[model samples]
Target: MIWKTIKVNFHRLGSPPTFYRLAEVLAPWLWGGFAVCAAIGLYQALYVVPPDYQQSDSFRILYIHVPSAWQAMAGYVVMTILAVIALVWRIRTVEIMAMAGAPIGAAFTFICLATGSLWGRPMWGTWWAWDARLTSMLVLLFIYLGIMGLYAAFEDRRKGARVACILILVGIVNIPIIHFSVEWWTTLHQGATIRLFSGESTLHESMMPPLVWMTIAVKLMFGAALLDRARNDLLDQDRRKGWVQSRLGETA
Candidate 1:
């Protein structure tokens, strides 16, 4: 019964109007959640949590850096799922969503790289290093740019999305590499301080709260951004359709 309900909703979401309406309704809520969570997280990270003995206030950067890095990878994973559904089911809405996610993911990747560099300058004595983790993250950024470029290259957006979906699938390998790079290679980047599966965390309990709050904030932010972009893409793609015309007429 649950599966049937989910199946019904999934099909309904494939309808452009339905998806657009859903995005419109949900995006504002997501953005609100992001704003609230980010405000709390920033407060806790800056004032509530004590500085690290070794790194001092500089380590606070991790509150932003870690979440951005996680969301960058998480956004790609969302795109991958959407891409697979798009390829297999030929769902137009899914294709639009998959394409729309690239820029948001790229933004997070840029933040990750930028913050990492800022954190590294004081710790590693260099602004940049070709370390395994850093190098793989840089590659991830390039992959995101490549996906965006490929999608924009074709005049037919659907055809471009199909080709880019293949690239999205191919890019999945980099996610695992990024996750394990610290373990696999000697990099300046630290290994996981908080382990989910093992239920072991090297980080102090007090420092964990900000990371938790910031991670949720970014996830909410990503969803909000994705839905906003996807809705715009849908409107642009379906501008000639009667439903879109009616929506525009109503809005106007």
Candidate 2:
């Protein structure tokens, strides 16, 4: 009985009205989590963590750069998965989720590019390189842009979403390329410091905490932003419906 009730609630949560209400309840908490995590993470990253013996103070940018890069890739994976659900189930809310996630993904990708350039300039002595990892990341950025552009081209957003969903699935090929490029080919970019298997992270204990915190912060920010955007999309879509009219009437 308990399991059945939970399953029922989960299904209802996928509906637009239920999701809109849930977003309203959850957005503030998620945003607050982002703020708190970001604050602690930045403090630890900027002041608590010791400077890299190799790169010196410049390496501090890793706090921002790594998290942004991680989220940039992670965001695409999430959108692609949601896109698949949207396509298979014909769930409009899930479709909105995919659309809402694209801009945030693109923003993080741009940050990754900019911060990577900054990191590279002093370390690699060049702002840009054709290194496999760097090139693949750049390609990832273009794919994100392509998704947004393709979505905007169609007169009907529903059709646009269907088209973009296909693109997302096709573009997922790039995620692995971005991740494994360093291993696959000769590259100037250093290998992963935080290995999931085998030995623990290469980072010192003090450094690892801040990086973890920042990663959590970015994820919370993504969730909060995604929910807010999805909620707005729902309201826009249902603007003429009675529930939305009543909600607006109450607010007015």
Candidate 3:
């Protein structure tokens, strides 16, 4: 019964109008959640948590860096799932959503790289290093840019999205590489401080709260931004359709 209901809703979401309306309704709530969570996370990270003995206040940067890195990878995984659905089902809404995720993922990757660099300069005595983790993350950013460029290169958006979906599938390898780079290679980047599967964490309990809050905030931000972008893409793609025309007429 549950599976049948899910299948029904999934088909309903493939309808452009249904998807657009859902995006419109959910995005604002997601954005609100992001704002509240981020405010609380920032407060806790900056004032509530004590500084590391070795890194001092500089460790606070991890609160932002870790979440951005996490969301960057998580966003790509979401795009990959959407891409697979698009390729197999030829669902136009899924294709647009897959494409919409690239820029947002790229933005998060940029933040991760930028903040990592800022954190590194003091710790590693260099602004940049070709460390395994850092190098793989840089590659991830390039892949994101390449996907966006490929999609734009074609005049037909659907065709472009199809080609880009293939690229998204191909790039899935990098995510695992990024995750395991620290374990596989000697690098300045630290290994996992918080382990999910093992239930073993090296990080102090007090520091965990801000990280948890910030992680949730970024996830919310990603969802909100993705839906907004997908909705805009849908509107632009369907501008000539009667539903879109009616929506514009109503808005006007």
TM-scores of the candidates in the order shown:
0.97, 0.96, 0.97
Preferred candidate (lDDT higher): 1 or 2:
1
lDDT of 1 by residue, 93-137 (tens): 999999999999999999999999998898999999999999999
TM-score of candidate 2 on Cα atoms, chains taken together: 0.96
Backbone clashes in model 2: 0
RMSD of 3: 1.1
lDDT of each: 0.96, 0.92, 0.97
- Whole-model alpha-carbon lDDT for candidate 3: 0.97
Ranking by lDDT: 3, 1, 2
Distance from true location, Cα of 47 in model 2, Å: 1.1
Which candidate would rank higher by TM-score, 2 or 3?
3
Q: For residues 1-252, what per-residue lDDT tens digits would candidate 2 score against the true structure?
A: 999999999899787888899999999999999999999999999888888899889999989999999999999999999999999988888998898999899999899989999989999999999999989998888998999999889988888988899999999999999998988998999988888787888877778988899999999999999999989978987899988998899999
